[model samples]
Target chain A: MEHRPMIALVGNPNAGKSALFNALTGAHQKVGNYPGVTVERKLGRLALPDGRAADLIDLPGTYSLDAKSPDEQVTRNVVFGHQEGERRPDLIVIVVDAANLDNHLRFTLELIALGSPCIVALNMVDLATRDGLELDADQLSQDLGAPVIPTVAVRRRGLDDLKAAMVQGIPQHAAPLPVHSEHAAPDADELRRKAREIARRAIVAETPTRRITSQIDRVVLNPVAGPLILLALLFVIFQAVFAWSEAPIAMIEETFAALQTGVEAVLPEGFLRDLIVQGVINGVGSVVVFLPQILILFFFILMLEATGYMTRAAFLMDGLMARVGLSGRAFIPLLSSFACAIPGIMATRTISDPKDRLTTILIAPLMTCSARLPVYTLIIAAFIPSTSVWGGIGLQGLVLFALYVAGIFGAVVVAMLLRIGVIKGPGGSFLMELPKYQMPLLRDVIIGLWQRAWIFLRRAGTIIFVTTIILWLLLSFPKPPAGSDQSLVEYSAAGRIASVLEPVLRPIGFNHEIALALIPAMAAREVAVSALATANAIEESEDEDETARTLGERLQGRWSLPTALAFLAWFVFAPQCLSTIAVARRETNGWRWPLFMTAYLFALAWLGAGATYWTAVAFGL
Target chain B: MRLTSLEPNHPAYVESIDWNAMSEMDSRRLRELGLHEGASIELLHRAGFTGRGAYACRIGRMIVAMRAAHAGAISVRTGAE
Candidate 1:
């Protein structure tokens, strides 16, 4: 049996390398991390044309072998076989954009110089031809001394040719690209000139380019119109995410309620039954019910990125972000925080500046992720009336908008403080390539959404399920010694802890129930409502009519205006879920930043809640 | 003239890279993006409300943004509007 060889894909940024990897590996891809770093490692099993299988690795994009960013460093190390635990590739597939041939050829040439068995995948050839760009692949292959195959990665064109080329028996000592390494390492200028010289030999422009991308950019990148268009687009996405998910969210809640009822009816009312019904179903359900909203948010985000509009948004935000000691690249990661801080913190890997990236990570949890949505919605619906305030705007909706604003404002303030106080340094400059816009491919969008949904579901099933059970135990244990005349929950361990913490929590208008609920809430923000639901006996119901009461209504029966407002304020600066903190710890490579983040956020939360409580009470609300 | 001093809609040719004012990494990145000496550059827009930073420019065929501090490294000669 011949050993299955390892093949690698390398390319310049935005060269459609990832698209090519997805096309080549389809359905067999798995994502992991590089040893000792958080950079994603995407690998898949590749079935070669010659009936041989290969391990495919997708290296992060870079312009040259000279390592500038951390991502590029990893790619360099892995390619040179200097990275520990990563075997050098048996073959390399260099995916180059035919349209951006000149910019990509420099890196392509460097890879060829490494004396590895390499093939150049000239990706996006269809777009190049349509745009009247002419490139002779044979001429390029002749010039570079490597097989150059034209491919439209999105359409999966030329995979068979690429596969055949990859598995072709080529010695490691084959012809290398011209390199004069003894001449003090050719600078960027010398290397670029060499690349252009190679490009001039094989490339031709068929016409005076009338670029539709330029025409679109003229509007989208305009100083005046650009910001306006971006704002309007963002506004629509925000409104749609909230409005479109309402019915689906309600359906999820109703289904969970039914499940709880069905499960409780069969069991004979014991600890196990209570744990399964109230703890698992109702508790995990509360967290899972917010999935639709998260999905909607992610769907829009994936679409914006696919269409290449996200870069323009970042370009528009660069100045504002720079003023706060962040680069424009931080915008995407910060935006991801609006969905969940875990992924957002992970996304911070894209920011190259260590100080800027750390600051972004620390402030990410303040973005009011979807987990916080359930808490805000419950409080707002209970306290604020749904009656139209402005011409026809619902007051409850207005409160939700205000909460979102509070979270954004909180993030900015914290970032600014950190910028001046702790991580004081000049802001990193933003240099981004705004890729030409294209219609987003539906298949990719669907796949992206499915992955996010699976991740959210897995979290709800595992972490939320286990935490809810522990909470259930806390509220269920220390049995009441046969009719001593107190509720079973109050006699349990959690109630005792709540009673002890009541004095501290009471200043912010939280009662024993809210205080107790805060324990499980550490696992996820959405669990607080469920903890209260079971703690207050609201979960004790047999009929749909009884169980169908919105968590908001049940909450209103107990909380005062001041109390609810304080809770809202607390969420605005919430320290983040445990998972998020754990991610921060991992990302920062130590406990220092994560511990600092928790301390600062808890302080902010306490102060915000305290102020709101006192102010609302002073107004006699 | 300092590249930062170039006005919008005006074209200039980079004459020399006085990279002494910036870090080696920034200078190398600029070079990689084709901002070397003798490369043509056009100021497209100065970003933000007060136009403080992240200036938009056309270098060769690509549109890129950079801070004024980094822009200070490239000395340019006015070409045309």
Candidate 2:
């Protein structure tokens, strides 16, 4: 007997449940993994008008309590109080899309039959009414045992009524008797028959409407035109990633340069000055400058997802993915890796097939995440000119596009190899809902972009900040004797370390400085640019004005055109980030796959970079 | 007939699920999707390489996309034309 009740929000996928949850919880939310599963459990605090604050958990969305998928299993287990650490909810909030009530209510009636204290939030009621369909809430509430409240989640309408209905618990006698089942659940025919009867009594009017979404799908989902639009959309996104980020990137660099100049002018020459200017400002600035590009890339991804095109894109890629031994369900997790591999890897839980999930996880890191943008942009700007390719497309943009293509090709090749080897299995089914296209809301897009930018900046403020300070100390310690003509950093501990690593890395054209930068870079791929900026900045601290040259120009002057190409090739396959490996270890629940992933990626990166360097050198560049 | 053989945009009723043709998980998955006997299905769209492709079908209020390989495991009937 808990004093405060725990309410769980459960719903079918695409039912506006998350929207309602977001509205009710606002900012009082915690997102974490369910016990022994990677599926995210989003919990929040809600205050009732009766002055009691309740704990609210948003369970994973599923079509039924049939528990076919991991997400559905979690939802069913949590609701039934079978999941470890998840208490049976004191009350259940069943969210049903107002327009899709017939399909949604089958699951709703099942929950109602469970004889729990529950309320039906007929979400997206505004949409239903707009289509000339009116839902009599009281009548529906009478037909079903629980109180039914019409809600428009996104607009925040009827939320207070929802809150009131939830807190004012209905009498136990109000609910109908549970429906008995043969398969422990009704077959398709029985469920549909019951659902139609319920709809007949509950819903008053209906329009046999062919929604505008289906009309648009006619062209967009057309066999030939669908793939073409997808390609064109991707091309535009890549162009925008390059074309849109230029001004913001330059402004950030200039700001950092000014800040460095300001610090140098105010302080007397000392190690403290070096740490502040080189360690903190320059190192962190290098990575933070990619924020614009990351935001642009994620904006496009969110828009595609919000508009329902992402699922269709998966449908389109199914045949192509099958060749790589992946189901269409793998598309989402693979696409998600373009943002970061951590979430991408965790997202594989949705792919029910173990071998398919493992293969998806193995190749996810090769998707050219936004973290690699800083390093890629740095090398590309220095090596590839701003010249146009075909009247409008910048050479830089085309190269960026080519790099992404390289990653996709690499992932496919790797997945194919895995399928043929250790992870070999029969083809898995790809079954998923293709949600009707909706206009992506401005609010959701802004929120998505904000979250991405916040994550990037938070990383810059924490991990990059601490690591850069350590890098500065390593690059500064072991001072030379006062009279020695040699520079102080030449005698630093990092100097010796770099020299030792240089020989082994030289075949791929990495010099001692690049070798030193590679050490801290294992913490994060973007750290390579920050570390590179720090290493080069210390070398040029003697001539502060020349430091005005962009880190790209400095890298250009030191590393040859071949080395830059080799570096880009290395990064494409590089297993640089330790966090991704740690996450993979946790997700797979073993050390074997993560270890194998790291070993294979390292070999691929080293050999690939070596070949590129030698080939470019042979061309006499 | 197999689901892939169904005409696009034409309504068909699921008559029986071919359990032996697909994996057990797939058979269970299809039933979970309301694709068992008496459920209505309309092949809204098909996309992929010509012979082998994924089919997007509307079954009740849900639109599901599945590969033709998985589609071949399902049998359906249409009202007499």
Candidate 3:
């Protein structure tokens, strides 16, 4: 068997590299992480015209080989064969934005200087043509001493030519890689000058065409109207996440509920039945039900990213974010945190500065992710009345809105404090390119959404599934004495553990039941609701007489208003989700920051709960 | 005049850049984006409440956003000036 040639796709940011990679490789892509780094590794198989297949790796988008962030460092290391667990590519396909040739060609020139066999895919040729720029690929190929193929990656144009060029260019066997030191760091300024000259020579004709992007940016980035439009857009997204997802969420809930009921009927009245119904169905269902909201939030996020509007949103939010000592770049990640912090924390890779990224990671949990919704709604329904207050706002709606605002407010304060204390530094520079707007390909958007959904489901299947089984076993075994008056839950191991946890939680107005729920809730924050229902001995199925009253009524009958309020406050600051902590550890590359994050968040949760509990008691609520 | 002082939509040529005015990483970014002396540029948009937080400019067919502070480091010459 001849060795499969390894080909790499390299480009400056927004150079349409990924789209071209998707077009060439189609569905044969494997996404993973580089060992010891958070940068994503995308590998696919490129089928050659000749009966052979080559491995194609899509490296991260970068401006130059001169590394700044970890993401950029991965690209540089991989291209130079220094990256561990990655073989040196046999060929490099440099993707450059055709319209931005003068700027992109600078990086292309630097890559060419590496003395590696290279081909240039002049991407986004359609957009360039629309901008009334005509380019001669032959002249550009001659000027750079590399083959240039004009491609519109999103439209799958020129992919055949690009693939053919790749097959002919990539070596069959491993070639002795050039020493990265041999490049001696080509002067970037000189490369820019050379790139400009080459680009000028390649352009056969040009006309000053009006760009729709600038026209849109004029209104979108307007000092007066930009912020308003952004806020309105966010309002619509939040409304949609809750409103549009209602039907699907109900369907998911009913499906799981029915599954639990079916298991109870089919299985014998023993450990397996209890484990399947309560442990598997209820435990995972609590999290799986969040899928609709997550998908909805990600759809908008993916569209924003594809449409080239994410940067504009960031630009508009820069002013407000700056007030908190963060740049506009942090805005998108923080916004994503509203739907889920796991992705939000992952999104922080866009913040190149270490301090900026760290600070954003720490405060992301304060954004009130969708996981906390069930707990909040349960408590609010049980405690706050539905009567209108202050004209037409329902008191329940006001409380929910206040909780969201509280999270944002807490995030603001924590960000400022972190900037001044722990992660102190001059603010990171917010230098970004606002790419021209284009219609995102439907195929690309679907692929992106699928990847995000798969990641979320995998987490639910593995970590949440295992933790639920353990918690169920702890609650199920050592059956209460034959005539015992104690309920099964109160007689279990978890009940005994909750007794010890009760003392610590007492100051914050929590009872034995709340303590029992808090333990399993550590796996995922949404589990708090199911755990609470179990502690109260409330049947989870809908047909039971007790279940007819709903979890809200059960909570209302058992807990004081102050305790419910305190629980809400606790969740607002609590870093209770294990997955979030794990992701923070991965993204930061160590236990140090994630551990610090957990510690501070726990401290805040305790203090906030205590204060809210005491304040509610004082007010005689 | 500093690039930040250039009125929006006024095309200008970069006269000189005071790379010493900012962090080395930021200066590298500016240079990498072709914001050096002799590059033609036009201020396209100003964002934020004060309109001083971030500035958008066009350089070589790309629109780039940078904080006003970074823009203040480069000097530019409009035709009239």
Candidate 4:
């Protein structure tokens, strides 16, 4: 039996490590949970020299082996083969940032200390050269006693040399350099002395280029201008999301509408028609329609992240974050939560302190994910007039912006409360490295957007598919009263259940239509749109305008303004999506936080919605 | 002087670090930044309010931050004067 070697891909965060891994392994990858943790372990097989294959593991990105966060801990553990059930890597391929090698080397040196066979793939070499960097790869390799190959992972450079080096194997147990230890960590003074000495001897830079990054950072990171610029950037992103996505969203809506009509027409007008048109078509179509918006949001985020502006943004936000008892590192995950809470919660694994991680998880759902977009768009479209403000700024878009702002405020307040009340611990300080800015790689950005779209489609096909079918069954069963001409749904089990639940929700301004929407929204919040579409008996039409007209007409007389606002308020705090809850459970490793999250969120939602309803009614809106 | 009091553009040589007194996470973080004892660093930017104690400093080319409490633990001598 031929024994193939194992090669581990390691790098600092945002060093194009994943893109490189994807380039190397391409469709040969499997994602699994690491033993005893929810952090994803990505493994794939790649062909080595001599026509044999080697296993490749993409380790989580960390700055150094001095692990702070659980994800970093796992990376450290797995690299040193300290993790149970994980084999020691035969060769370690360190992915270093070509432009920012000074900091990247910290981790590289730590990896070297592990005494593993190693090679350095100087990634992002293109960016470094663009910035007028001259690296002596051979000299650096000789200095560190390792083979260093310059690579542009995004452009697929240096793969052959990297692979050849992997197959050739590195010198085993080379003299240990003075680097940070992986385990039995030395005292802080000793580590610093070693780091300084290593830097003094191994690293050298020619005349420092007065880079444009510092000039831009001067204004963007200015105390007064920084926050304003951040606000403006956020405003522009949301405005662009709403403005640019409208055309594509309309197109998707029209397509789905035509498909729904065709499905309804071909299938007999009975159970089969209902299931196909209402459950499968309407349910999946409603959620999938927002794909353009989700993709657009991710596109901008990936662009910002790739260009290295996000780290500076985090640096700018450090003070505010610390005030709320979170490190600056928490900003990335929280910002990601605005796109979707599940991944946002997962990203919190990067936070080192257990208290910070748990607090981040507890409040992540309040970040107004894209799932809430459908509900916000629906309510705002129905209630807020589509008038523009300040020369073509959509009033509806402003309201949508306000809703997002409210969610962020709520999350921060909750985080503050949790820090003081529940997870009473000293907030961890922020210490992050801001990488040099570069134009984002087009390939990586597109691939990132594609991955997000794939995740959304997958969710629609699986969780939303099954839940909608079950909901359709419950809502369509048991024929109406014998003497009545009402549709079966009017007297069905779902209708009865909604009516019974209506009294409890009445104080929150929810009628049977809104109450019925909640049942399906539990699976995924975006499913509420389809639930409402089905409940209102809006027939499938080929034209998007007609579908919008039908929905608007159905809701016009039935829902009061207060009720619409109240429903938005409800979702502002609603613990409706079980996927987020499941992620919270997995991340926390206990039922306690998720349960607490659900209970408190539900209570807050009820109170908030009820307060909005009564307050609006008192004003006689 | 404590590391926290260093003014912007002031260079400092780290004299000592009380690693045992610090949180394990903080110690690990400090090590990652190359800020262990004997490293010379410079305070680059102090953007946040003093009460909150958020500041950015550079050790070589890598910039990092810590709260006032943690920064107070590291002894340094300013080279500015």
Number of the top TM-score candidate: 3
Q: Each candidate's lDDT (Cα)?
A: 0.80, 0.80, 0.88, 0.76
Kindly list the per-residue Cα lDDT of model 3 for residues A69-128, writing each as its tens digit.
787899899888999999988999999999999989999998988888899999999999
In angstroms, how far off is A215's CA in candidate 2?
Answer: 0.5
Clashing pairs in 1: none
Task: Output the lDDT of residue A575, model 1.
Answer: 41
Residues A450-539, candidate 4: write the lDDT tens digits: 767877788779877887788888888877768887666667778788888899998778998888888778888977776677688776
Two-chain DockQ for model 3: 0.81
Candidate 4's docking class is acceptable
Fnat score for model 3: 0.87
Candidate 1, superposed: residue stretches over 4 Å from native:
A169-189, A261-269, A390-392, A540-557, B1-12, B78-81
Report the lDDT of model 2 for residue A354: 86
Question: Can you give the DockQ of every candidate in the order shown?
Answer: 0.51, 0.65, 0.81, 0.46
- The reply for model 2, stretches above 4 Å from the true place, is A1-3, A66-70, A81-88, A126-140, A170-193, A200-205, A250-273, A346-349, A381-400, A481-490, A537-561, B49-51
Candidate 4 stretches with Cα past 4 Å from truth are: A1-4, A12-16, A22-32, A63-68, A80-88, A97-110, A113-115, A122-143, A152-157, A170-199, A204-212, A383-401, A484-487, B18-21, B48-53
